[model samples]
Target: MSKTDFPRRENFCEFILIRSVGNDSYLGNIWSDEAKFTKNGLFKRHNSHYWSNTNPHVFRERNFQESWQFNVYCAIRTDRVVALEFYQENSNSKL
Candidate 1:
């Protein structure tokens, strides 16, 4: 989908924590950095992909992660995640 499709919101942040569940031999643990809400109100960045080693086919086959901790700025509305703009904390140049 085009980036524009994801509308940016304001003053929001979300932190997601992902972990492995069982001996599925496919999944892995992951810990994402705090997802800041950009002007569009969507998550900015996602860090840590635990299952990077597995094949795409196998990775998609099973559900393996145990739990997720989402430290969101506001209450989650629906399944739809608000869009946001991503920017570095420290930048020398202007946009």
Candidate 2:
């Protein structure tokens, strides 16, 4: 995908890392709408966070054979992710 297809680099602020629970890892990307203003004085105004989760069962169903699996979490706005936390499943606790 082209750079434009993704959120503006200038608008990106930070990434919140979420721990895996039940082999699912959640992640959040944060951004600011004001930073998306173009040089021509036009504001794109699309501020939001992207979240994703990883699931081992889904991966295995897809023919993935990895010993460990993770799910990613996503968010649409900075406020949506007030805090980041990580959790370990019984299988992953040893690691």
Candidate 3:
């Protein structure tokens, strides 16, 4: 594949990883700076939601640190995410 086939580094963003308390289960979600997940945070980035379904206001650092095993992962492109969530979905299904 050519360099053109790869997404530019600037397009890449940080993601969040959430580890469930008292269990081995883990979750990777969108990134949010407000969470301040320095150790737990992933490379995914810039204002995205921290978790899949959990509200940002609720799934915060205080609660997470209290419970522990929280937060991050690898890189993902926001542009691709938008394309899949909006453009691709419109073509794929009505939902």
The reply for model 1, stretches above 4 Å from the true place, is 1-23, 43-95
Q: Write the per-residue lDDT of candidate 2 for residues 1-95, one digit (tens) a residue.
A: 35784565434422333232332334333532112222233223243323445643332123335434332223354347543333233223452
User: Which predicted model would earn the best lDDT?
Assistant: 1
| Residue 70 displacement (Å), model 3 | 18
Rate residue 49 of model 3 by lDDT: 51
Each prediction's total of clashing residue pairs, residues at least 3 apart in sequence or on different chains, is 6, 18, 10
Report the C-alpha displacement of residue 5, candidate 1, in angstroms.
8.4
Model 1 per-residue lDDT tens digits across residues 1-95: 46754453211221121222344432332322335543433444444244556565543232346422233332222343343334545223452
How well does each candidate superpose onto the true structure, as a TM-score? 0.17, 0.20, 0.16
In candidate 3, residue 33 scores what lDDT? 27
Instruction: Kindly report which residue stretches of model 3 are placed more than 4 angstroms away from their true locations once superposed.
Output: 1-6, 10-37, 42-45, 48-57, 61-95
Q: Assess candidate 1 and give its lDDT.
A: 0.36
Candidates 1 and 3 compared: the better one by TM-score is: 1
Poorest 10 consecutive residues by lDDT, candidate 1: 9-18
Quick one: how many clashes does candidate 1 have? 6
- Scored against the true structure, residue 94 in model 3 reaches a CA lDDT of 38
